[model samples]
Target: MKQLVILAGGKGTRLKDRLGDLPKPMIPIAGKPLLQHQIELAGAHGFGEVLLFVHHRADLIQEHFGQGSRFALPIRYITEKEPLGTAGAVLAGFDQLADRFVVMYGDTMMNVDLTRLWSAHEQSGADATLFLHPNNHPLDSDLVETNAEGWVTTFHNRPHAAGQFFRNLVNAGLYVIEKCALEPWSHDRKLMDFGKDLFPALLNRNAKLFGYNSPEFIKDIGTPDRYDWVCAQYEAGIVQRSSLATPQRVVFLDRDGTLVKEVSAQGLHRIEDLELLPGVSAAVHELNQTGLRAVMITNQPVVAKGFCTEEELQQIHNKLETLLGREHAFLDRIYYCPHHPEKGFPGERPELKIECKCRKPEPGMVLEAQRDLNIDLANSWFIGDTTTDVQTARNAGVKSILVRTGHGGADRKHDVAPDFVFESLPEAVQFIAARSTETSGE
Candidate 1:
């Protein structure tokens, strides 16, 4: 049986006033200590044994949960005479740490699937898998940049540059790490942190560090305002829906007019012609960070018209991916329609000229992606610049947003009527991020 390690050794300096004599983990939340909530959640997720690393007022915690027989969740403690930072505490418990174990901060009340997180860690074959989520305030929070495969490439702590926009993925203070990954620093016996010290060293060695971006609610009630908000969320039962109970949300985007500047009258036949519009990279990167899958659904009839071959189309996509990668952005998947109904062009290819279901206005690409990604259409949103795009969302039973960047101005009067209209892709993304906490039915 794997162990769940809870770091309950913090002094709670910021919360000292309200929680006078009590440790941060023992602070009451919804009529129970925060540690109790964490224990119950772990037990519910099949974690029968919990290893708590405690320092401040350790005796109080040990006496309260004695042997854990009452709750059926056995408890063990690793008392530290002096304060050990997050990672240091784990080293102290090195003898008992399992081959693979979970590490979570005791200050947070989060509703996540430990089972799924464990599964992700096992499948990734990574040294560590950090729990990442999009916080309301990205600019002021520590951000993480990841590739399309969810590998953590960079870590940007708070107090970033003076005026720089960044993706909103924040470390939620939960992790699944392998015991062998700590061998290098196990003998130090000094204060060390996962973020400030260990993670940076691992990144320098090109370690396999992945990020599990989850939409599940995870909040640290460190300040008074945040505490009140968490209490309100619990009272409203929003916490329950934020669990694995709800489906993941997706943002389906259009390629030409929406993501990049559309070509004049000619089709995109060369990679040099691909230019990402203003803020498109940042917007897509934000989607990547927000735990929302950013998928590209475009209609590329140039292949059937003989303007470009399928290989050339692939080259164009490669250019787009390279551009986005340069800005720390990536698309989860790209789906394009290469067929056209009317083929009278001089160099048209008959094999690729057949009418297909994947073209815009037909929900073929969206439906196929939904089937493959297990997406919930009702909770997803489609953003495009043409009337066909709006109609496609309607056909797929998902919400649609028409942007003014591409052909949006002329397509606004379409009969299908978009759910919302924005001036650009960034505006649409802003709207979606702001409403990320809203409840979804399907």
Candidate 2:
């Protein structure tokens, strides 16, 4: 029955170029808003009630998740007319919080076991416990040096301070704080941040502020590259997603190479060349029987290059559906990117070539499929034959299996590496199906 407060008020300046008008927390990752994933994780970790501190575009947050009942957790929102620093927002929302609670950053993603954190905090009897991680890039973080017993002895926020400390533990942006620690601040104070003001003040008073070292999967999506990295991790299955029931997983397929024989760039021009690879239909049928969705994510630059029309693409898909039906295998959804680089051809529109987020090597298409189809990126795997496909799965945070039939075998020698490699689509499918059964204890 722990209470949680999520600080989701930032303007997300770093993600503005990619996200446009959307708030940072609302940015989509694997089809759902980042904030939704955080909330769902909290619910899974046993947090019964949550308070979202929102400032910019608060309406969007409220609109998408009214009361949080759908996620099986009670939720409330606290809006601020003006930007409140981290500590200020917490102080303003103090009335809603209980005697003790956990505070987390909405823009960051982590698979932290909060139960362990709570237990550690209680055992130490500290006023606050800061979740800490080993600082791989200490130059760009607020570094902390802790004693053997985990009591933080020194804090440094600059690169020059690196050699001075004996350890490299940095704050992980998650904290468990007792209400009494925040009593010094007045709710109306205009500027106050935990790292800059509050924590220093606590140290000055010789308060018991401790660090809990748990180097779990933690990431801060503060910039476009980092946001992209987080998406890749989600696609790769490195990040665990919250789920009920048997924890359903998905299988993402590449249409061109693995599903059908390689159509020489010229031959792929018509529906006649589109054919399912050996055993592909039966493999998909087996996944369907097990309640797994077989989704197709592809990059069809042929449309952007003027080799085929959108109508022609639909016709090709129609032919695929007809073929799958003959073998009793159905595609749950098909996502394609029609954009090509601006220098694709003489007739290619520069606008189409302009860096689109949904292109392969980007997680946009797969993420859109996840959102529309409710596929779990963490538990799912993408099977493709090209390095671009591998990069796409890496960026989306899903595990990848390279099948030799398409560009997979060639991709094995490429710069990007996949988690698994198979000689053909059927081989990859058989491996994943067997692994799924083992995971299910069947």
> 1-442 in candidate 2: lDDT tens per residue?
6898999887799789977878788888899988888888788788989999998888889999999989999999999777778888899877788888999988887776777778889999999999876433544667676764789877877554312322345688899999888877756557788876788788888889988865355778999888997887667554553221223477989888888888785437587777788898788777654545677888888777777877787768756755665576666556788888757485565556656888788899888876544567898999988887888888999999887776655654347888998888778888887887677554
Cα-lDDT of candidate 2: 0.77
Can you tell me which runs of candidate 2 are displaced by over 4 Å? 161-166, 241-442
Shift of residue 417 alpha carbon in model 1, Å: 5.5
Counting clashing residue pairs in each candidate, in order, gives 0, 14
Cα misplacement distance, residue 306 of candidate 1 (Å) = 17
Instruction: Give the C-alpha miss distance for residue 259 in model 2, angstroms.
Output: 45
Per-candidate TM equals 0.70, 0.55
lDDT of 1 by residue, 1-442 (tens): 8679999977678888878978888888779888998888888888868999999888888888887897788899999888768988888778888888899898898778788888889999999999987555555667787876799988988787753444557788999998899888777678888987888789998789999876677899888778777877776555655565355578999998899998966677777788999999899888765567788999888988898987778768856765675576777667899988996899998998787888888889999887645687888999999888899999999999999987874855457788899999999999997787454321
